[model samples]
Target: MKAFQELAETLSTTLAAHGLVLRGGFNFSAGEESPTGPSNAPAKSVLLVGQTGSAPWPHFLRWWERQPRDLKDPLDSWSREVIGAVAYEFGARAVSPSDRPFLPFQQWAMRAEGLKPSPLGILMHPEYGLWHAYRGALLFDREISIQAPENPIHLCDACIGKPCLNSCPVGAYSADGFAYETCLSHVRGPKGAPCRDAGCIARNACPYGTEYRYAAEVQAFHMKAFAGL
Candidate 1:
């Protein structure tokens, strides 16, 4: 336990310097299959890494300014570079949401943090609301003492009106599920200027984490990327 705490502290400090946070972690349960790690060994534990609200905005902006404008998926690439170094130094293996085989990040997050998906599918933290994300994970060969969050709070349950469900101009999200082509087409045309200039209207309507909402520039950057502009 001491060793795990020490390792977590050291890694958390390093990640903080880069605008990332150790969202949380957990040890694999007995009989559970674990993620593959160094040398193809099954990892015994994992620490989820990510950001809250605009935590990574400024840092990512600085890093983005240094890379070529045509750089593909700069955010994912940057996460790989930074977390990969952290993994090397700590003798752990790095995995990302974008990795091939598509590790079950959403499941891992739900288990570690006791968070459930909001109507928009982003994990809704009682504190962060809809403004948090899981960027990467660090896999370890040894078990780490960590606790799963308790008494999980699903804010959407108490959120009457559910403004998020009604804010979109194209009615892209509904009980039937998301209309992907509808959303994409809308954002790609001139009719989408407002959505293109800002972030998702539905996302913004989620009032739980108003204080943690992304800055205009940060939201604009993501909007452009989502619209493939």
Candidate 2:
């Protein structure tokens, strides 16, 4: 167990410098079900890896700029290179959110942290609001003891007026559900410059963890990716 803890700590510290954190994890040996069903990778446990706020944006941008422009999914490709190297060093298998046999990351997150979904369908983090994101996971052949985070206060429940529902001009988010096509159409239209340049208006309207909001450039980058611009 000491060795496992040490390994986890080393990986956690190394990832922290790049603004990624050991979000949560579970041991399949302890009878915790596999979120990805069955895998032949000899994984005995899985560690959830993610980022909060915009701390990684600058570093990612610098690294991304240095990569060949012709490469597809540069961000995901870069993440695979960095995280995969770490997994290799630790004798673990690295998996990404973009990987096939698509792992149920949202389920893994909820089970590992007791997190609830927000109005926009994204997991509502207590400290990062909607600004946080899960990037990838590391699958180990040995079980590592990991403590689940206590259930946090659902900030959305207490929010009066639910600004996220009203902030989008195209009514992309509402009580009914998100209007995916409506949003995409609006974002690709002539009037989409604001959303294209600054990210989703509804997401920015969330009051929780306002301090962790991404910078304009970072937000714009994400918007561009979402819009395929």
Candidate 3:
């Protein structure tokens, strides 16, 4: 079998064992530096990104919720561990963006590759809604070629009301963009209702992922962590 096929199988087995159900539409691109030219970065040298499910992220989410307001630094370790495993499997490294070494993937997707926009941004998938978060990414060392699908399966195309855009209490998300301060203030207020309890109303309003329900308790846990409540 080719390296790409092997990598896919290995990823499927590894993530499935952890109760993560890998879906289609995982777009892989070449890394910044490679033996071959940028245009020639084989599909094999890839970045693995997918949504969470099969095992609910709520267990982790809930733990994050109850953490004392001041002690959340430990969660960063968990993030590294999860992202690292996938990187190792692919003989690649995990790149989490920092203040330095700003990522070019988003720009590459838009300018060079010609994706209309980020897939998740459009509410295209019915299963994940907006509740799903892109937690980690994996990068491979070598290049390999895989067949590209003819067209992207955009799940958000059918929705008319676009509940995700409207559901937010603060209208943080819209065609325009997010208002970070407005969202942060609501979640952080001493007496305000916690964002974790009900979840991000806008995210919850998505019609996708019937099987992937965001439990309220889990939502509250995430909210408290995010809001520092």
* Candidate 3 lDDT tens digits, 80-187: 566567666556566543213555544323322223432225333334544444444555434445554444454566678877787677777877777777888877
What lDDT tens digits, residue by residue, belong to model 2 across residues 1-229? 6766787789889888777888888777655555432245456788888888887777687888888888777778877887887777777778899988787889888877778999999899888899888888888776777765688998889999999998999999988899999999999999999999888999999998889898888888778878887
Alpha carbon lDDT of residue 129, candidate 2? Answer: 91
Pitting candidate 2 against candidate 3, the one with the higher lDDT is 2
lDDT of each: 0.88, 0.83, 0.53
Number of the predicted model whose TM-score against the real structure is largest: 1
Cα shift from native, residue 1, model 1 (Å):
3.5
Query: Residue 74 error for model 2, in Å?
Result: 1.3
Against the hidden reference, what TM-scores do the models get? Answer: 0.96, 0.92, 0.69
Q: Which parts of model 1 are misplaced by more than 4 Å?
A: none
The reply for model 2, stretches above 4 Å from the true place, is 1-4, 29-42
Which ranking of candidates, highest TM-score first?
1, 2, 3
Report the Cα lDDT for candidate 2: 0.83
Clash numbers, per candidate: 0, 0, 11
Q: How far in Å is the alpha carbon of 81 misplaced in model 3?
A: 1.2
User: lDDT of candidate 3?
Assistant: 0.53
Highest lDDT among the candidates is held by which one?
Answer: 1
